[model samples]
Target: MQSTLERASHWLALLCKIVAGIALLALLGVTIADVSTRYLYRLTEGAIALRVIGSVELVSYLMLLSLLAAMAANVEKSQVVVEAFSHGLSPNLKNRLHGVYLLGFAALGLVLFIGLLDSATAAARHGEVTQDLRLPMGPIYYMAAVLSLLLGLRSLIHALLSAVFGAEGEVSHGE
Candidate 1:
């Protein structure tokens, strides 16, 4: 059962990374397009209005959202953590520390998720909209909430499994 759960977590983590990679590429493409369009064009009044009112606003906001997704995925994988202590600890201790670290991370993710949801709700109440396109801000907030929940879940599963099985079993760290 522990092995199965660990395998499932690994698969889920892999899926998250793949999704993050795709989002990062989309963000890069949007950024390049935005920059290229700005540098190559001298638009008339109407065209300028359209650019300001359409693609620019959408692309910019979506790129930011996508980047956040990628960042959250990295955090979920513990890739963002410094590894200076790994070499000094026994594998079992290292694994237990990892579990504690993940639990802390999961708590943080939950806090952020709640904060974002509150902010989004407030924005929605105030009818907040994007500057140029006037797109609703609530959806972006909800997206952030979704990403945060995913990270929280990832951390939680790892932490719980590590705590319960640390004595008899452990997740492989390539050690």
Candidate 2:
């Protein structure tokens, strides 16, 4: 009973959640390894010589990816509502207002997507790389831009559903 767009959005949200989970796991693993290495090094009086090079840079990238990837799934679930102000409003009006609120988020996501794409283009043009790992930054920026685009699209869909159809209940929680 769902449109293709709705089904696609659901699938995309699922994919994004999976990506977020993987990135989080990777981040945790890196942090644990780095901490263990540092502890062992200190305990061995620097004889072990084990250190995670570029660990900080890696962690930062992973964190950003995870956060961005989660945005699509969190859009509807994370909205703030003022019950006192809206309690008296009719349900139809509330749905329209919520749609407008979601539109704002869609706008924000679109802006970020544009900015990230520009940054990715510039990074690719300049052959930029991460400081510690020397990994190409263009790909990372492009990935982030894609995620931002997904967020925007998802918000737009929710906005349409709410405003046009007055759909109620949560669509997804990224679970």
The lDDT leader among the candidates is 2
The residue pairs in collision within model 2 are: none
The predictions' CA RMSDs to the true structure, in order, are 4.5, 2.1
TM-score of each: 0.72, 0.93
Per-residue CA lDDT of candidate 2, range 1-175, in tens?
A: 3366567768888888998999999999999999999999999999998989999999999999999999876676656789999989988888778878889889988999999999999999999999999999999999999999988988887787777777642564346
- List clash counts for every candidate, in order: 0, 0
How far residue 69's Cα lies from its native spot in candidate 1, in Å, is 2.7
How accurate locally is residue 169 in candidate 1, as Cα lDDT from 0 to 100? 26
Q: Candidate 1, after superposition: displacement of residue 23 in Å?
A: 2.7
